[model samples]
Target: MSSQRSSKTFLQLKYGEALDTAATKKSITSLLSSHDGTEVIHHCLKEGARWGMSPDSEEPNTLEAVYILSGKLKLHRPNEGSFLEAGDFLAGQPVSEFIVLTALEDSEFLYITSNPVFHYYSSDTRNLEMLAIEIEKKDGYTADHCFRIKELSMLVGEKMELNSESLQKLHFGALLHDIGKTEVPESILLKPAKLDEEEWTIMKEHTRYGATILRKTNITHFILAAEVVEQHHERYDGSGYPKGLRRDEICLEAAIVGLVDSYDAMTSERIYSKARSKESALTEIKQLRGIKYHPEVVDYFLSVIE
Candidate 1:
């Protein structure tokens, strides 16, 4: 099942490519993943630096996601607005003749670009992010639940030796897995009270709704993510989910997310439950084994946790 690991390439943003040479500049960009016209990049920007997203450049039509990897910087509307600290993601298309960046300090970013899908999925992708923020606002404990799931899912994905495309899909799948929850009524979503059987049934439909939303968005690349979203609540033993999918029937990414989702659920406090100790959570996960999760996935998850 192993494939040739994609080569990671280093690239320099030219005078007008990523940095406005006319303005102050110092920056570096690395290519992380590229498939189906999308490129994932790692960018490092230094102090007193200014970068440009000129609509007249080589890759001008690119849709980009800039996630601050480290350090801090003031960024918003090329020359206007406030600072965005590390961990914040800025997504958009080139809106002005030249959108420039001024670094308040040395900063790094993770950029995801897809010339094709960016046009269609850009707004939706960012919208989902906003929804995630709303979820955190509604439940403070889940401040970065989607991000955590993406991180943990990627960790498991790497352990499984997933190819670059799979990893990318897994990453998106993990991030938007809970987007369907947006449809759930706030009265039930933020009830702070035990949900009755009907409510529980409605809650379980989030997976189905999530899958539908991903597909309906016309994000062709996200079809994989759609599958993961739907199957994430499924069990290896044919018990979990709206579909009762069993072993091997569920996609690998879904299984990975399912295991981690449960792990995180057990270890993190939420509107419905209190957090379990790490050891206690791990113990419960271990006990589930072949019952709740895929055996190989469980083994890999256990190995990573230990």
Candidate 2:
């Protein structure tokens, strides 16, 4: 509900000057036109790109009609999946289940919706970005930590040949992994020595906090990031907090973030621990491969940083 129909009766938007715009690595969305809560959007997706929407009960009554203007697509929903092609149309709302569209090839589409979603999505992304900045500044030991993690995670994702959409989710997941730490006390966050058992327990709750913060946004990308944030601490050997998921039970994106986070934390200065040399860190990571981190993630990450 961030945008409303303008008072003016008529308007014109040039091809290059869209009303609103947003993009990810695999797709670009342009708010080409709007009228009385109805939004006409233009989407260009790279081959194999994917878009997902999860159920949200708090959302206003909303519906969407998508017309595939060009190329092929596949629709995936609970217990059903179908293919789409040029001129095909589908309409529905994610009221109680998840919906996903995957581009079978380079494609273009028109998405007409009763909800003016672009504004809300754009606003949420901006606000969350600002929040990430604030969170980073709040933690003295984590200066630029999120940024470094994001960069490293992307490299590993690329080395592993993850698609664009997966990479985008990994990007935000790594950048906001520590957002839950905002709830921790400053005394504990800035403590000069190692944390006691109680403080460690509280610190471990940051993953849950980060997941909750993201889910509250009700945005698809954030929802994916929330999963990664929550599970990033879980070890491959099933020794982790909040959940004991191991190996394939963990999200691949979360596994990547966890590995990169460990390496970065090992090499970065912290109040309680001295920075380890990069060689020492890699050696330690090698020693723990398939035990603390996913085996494949460790292989690619070591190759990337090497």
* Global fold similarity of model 1 (TM-score): 0.63
lDDT for each residue of candidate 2 in 1-306, tens digit (9 for 90 to 100): 112222101111111222123232456778999999888988887775555444445554667677899988776543445788999987766334444566779888887877667665445554555566566666654545666687689678766767544655686688788888778787786777788999999888989999999887655667767989999999999998669889999999999999998898889886567899999999999999999899999999988899
Off by over 4 Å in 1: 1-42, 45-123, 136-140
Each model's lDDT comes to: 0.66, 0.71
* TM-score of each prediction: 0.63, 0.64
- Candidate 2 local lDDT, residue 172: 68
Candidate that scores best on lDDT: 2
Reference-based lDDT, residue 56, model 2: 47
Residue by residue across 143-218, what tens digits does model 1's lDDT show? 5676668668866776676654455557668877887887888777788888899999998898898899877754
- Model 1 deviation from the true structure expressed as Cα RMSD, one decimal place: 13.3
